[model samples]
Every structure is written in structure tokens, then in C-alpha cells.
Target: MSQHAVLDNNTHRDLRVRIEPNADLGDAIMSCVTVPAEFRQVQAHFPILFHKNQANGAFNAIALFGFENGENLFLEGGKWDALYRPLALSIQPFLIGRSADGDGPGQVHIDMDHARTGDANGVRLFDEGGQATPYLEDIASRLGLLDAGYRASEAFFAALRQHELLEPLTLEIELDDGAKRSLVGFHIIDEERLRALDAATLGELHEAGYLMPIFMALASLSHITELVARKNRREAHG
Candidate 1:
């Protein structure tokens, strides 16, 4: 397969497959930022609805995973303060979309003040007029974005598997703006000992810098994958 095609497939497969515990932060972000049943439950409580842009024609949806207190935060919101508070911890956002899906319809603003009671378990959604609607459950049930996010992730992993770069490699690229950016994915095929890389190569990336987050993600994924494999083996033998 062509390099582009291979990479695309590999990305998709990677999405479907959970990240190994050894995966670095990037992988962890990808794996954990998925839309699952638990996340759906959370979304059911706090639903933020918005429209997406049109250029791409595919499914449109995004799933955000963060921390608010002890509970996990997942919702759709434009304003950072509304969805994330200063005290919140480990806040990360994931966007899911496609060309076919087109931009979302009208936007709906939810009022957190009235929606949030003393309960910290989940979020509550409000209507346009800032009124509580009994149909919250019904609205949550029909959220298509959550499912769309899962599908998008699967597609990304599949693309990666096709590339045969699943092992581990560092990606270094030079942007059009004359800036260099280095990102370490789950695979790291080559290692630079700082001294080996020429001054020119190093200089390009000096401003953009290398992202260590991807390494952390890969480590986390590797660990999770091992745990899952062990559990499966035990079950089979038992």
C-alpha cells in the first residue's frame, strides 16, 4: 500500500485497540479520551450542543475528557470556564469530526449555575432560556457526537496499523512557517543523543521543541495492553 494509505489504516486500527500501559501521555490521551458507556452517562447529565464547520464531509462530533473534583468531566462546551474551572485537574479536550458530517446546527447555551445543585456526581443541562427541561434524559439519549467520536478514533488507529509503524518512533517535521516540530508517537524507531543530531537539524526544532507528552502516552498504553493480555490468558487457562 502507499505510505499515506498505510498510515491511515494504521491510525484506524490503533484507535480500536486500547493503548498499552507502556504508552506515553499522547497514547493515554488518545485511549482514555474515547467515548464509552461511562462517558455517555456523564454526557447525559451535562449536554453541551453545538454546530461544527462544514469543509469536511463526514461524521461530526467531539468528546472531551477532563477532571472536575473526583468525578470525570465530559461535555460539549465552547467556553473554557463553563466546562472547566480553575480548580479542575488534568483537563484535556479531544475533537472528533468529518467532512461529510458538516457543521452542527444551532447552538445551545447551558446555564451551570442553576443546573449544578450541591451534587458533584454529574452535570445538568439547561434549555436556551436557562430553564431545566424534563427531557434532559431524552436529549442525552440521542447524542450522536459520542458515537461519532468512537468511530473517528477507530479510523485513526486503523490508519496507523496500515503504516507498520506500530513499534515506536519519533516524528520530526518542519512546518511551513520555518519552524520545526518533533512529536514522539507510540513508536520510536530512531534515537538522537543530542550530540548526534547536527546543529541545523536541532536548530529547526529549537523553537518548536520536542513534545515529550507522546512518550508518556505510549508508556501508559503499553502498561494497559499488558494487563489486558494477562487477564485474557488467565481467563483462558482457568
Candidate 2:
């Protein structure tokens, strides 16, 4: 369970957190929720997919890291092997918290029980003068980016669904040893449908600032091939 509390310098002055990428720090994730605003960066490293929310019937964009659960191929030798790590993963053990009525600016909340928290040799969140450190400032900036991106993603997905651009994705992989794997219950943008969109509809999507992200998501599918290569390499070494 998570022990969440509003971050305060006076209450948690000596707190330090591990910021490195490692499985021990809960970095062994196969996928994470992403936003349309991050597609440009995320596309360069990972495959992007959409997942449907069964309860609300909404769609959430995701960045795929591995073929199996809890397998992050990008993590090796205590380092992330990518130029751009998703903002969602960079902000660890901390999340944006809203007020009781959920009608105000967000606050930074920390999960005290997380593996990244309470490390003796980790980065300090505040200075002796009770001012925020550079590390904490960076985290706050990332939290802002994530929160804004999350809100914008709603409209982006709404546009995709409105135009019927999403289609069920069926991905299958074969390893060097002849083992087979498959990804289920994920969706991808339908290129054919996108190409068939009328001029007026394309204009609508463009004006709404969602067209580039659509293409970015399509381009990101190429990274799936690279992920398979990484998996094969890991298996060979084992």
C-alpha cells in the first residue's frame, strides 16, 4: 500500500530519494500511461499504443517497453538505455494531488513507502534553509508537464474516437529459440481510415492540434521491432 502525504520541507527535511533507473527501485515496468504531448519524444524510443478503460469507456495512450509483464528491456546494468525516458517514469514516488473538492491547483504528494524514498545516499529534496533543491524543482516541473499532458490527452483521444481512427492491434513476436509471444487488448491508429478522412475532417483534427500526434503514434510502431531485438539479445546471453 502507498503512504501518501503532502510534501513539506519542515516535516520531512532529511528525506532523500534514489533517482537512478533500476529494477530494485520499481523500474521494471512493461508499459506506462502516456499522453499525446509526449508522443514526439516517446515515439523515438518506444512503441505507442492505446488501451480502453472498461469502466469509463475511455482510451488511454501508453508507451510500450517490453513484450511481457514486468519486463522493461530498456533497463540494463542499472541504466535506462534510451535517450528520452518518458516523463511519467521520471517522476517516481511522487504524484499530483488535488484539493478535497478537486477544484484547485495540484500539490506534490510523495509516497513514503516507495522503494525510491528514504535512501541514505539519494538526492536531497530540500536544502538546510528549507528551500527546494534543484532536484525537487525539476520534479515539480515534470509534475506540471505530466498534469497538463494528461488533461490534453483527453481531447486527443476524444478526437481519435470521434473520427473512428482507432483499431484493435494484434502484435505477435517470435524469438530466436522459436518461442512465440503476443500482445492482446491494445489499439493502434488505423492508417487506412486516417488516409480516407475527408478534407474537412482532417482540417478539424489539425486545427485541434491532434494530427501530428496521430502520425507520431503511427511512426512509433517501428520501435516494436527493436524491442524484439533486445529481447532476443537478453535471451541469448542467458
In order, the Cα lDDT scores of the candidates are: 0.29, 0.94
Scanning candidate 2 in windows of ten residues, the lowest lDDT window is 151-160
Expressed as tens digits, the lDDT of each residue in 10-51 for candidate 2 is 998889999999998988999998889989999999999999
For residue 114, model 2's alpha carbon misses the true position, in angstroms, by 0.5
Residue-pair clashes per prediction, in order, are: 70, 0
lDDT of 2 at 4: 96
Residue range 76-128, candidate 1, lDDT tens digits: 13222233221111211112233345555422222212212123343333344
How many pairs in model 1 have backbone atoms within 3 A of each other, for residues 3 or more apart or on separate chains, i.e. clashes? 70
Q: How much is the lDDT of residue 136 in candidate 2?
A: 98
Highest lDDT: which candidate?
A: 2
Where model 2 places Cα greater than 4 Å from the true spot, the runs are: none
**Clashing residue pairs for model 2:** none
Error of 1 at 68 (Å): 30
User: RMSDs, each prediction?
Assistant: 19.0, 0.8
Please tell me which predicted candidate would have the highest TM-score against the true structure. 2
lDDT of 1: 0.29
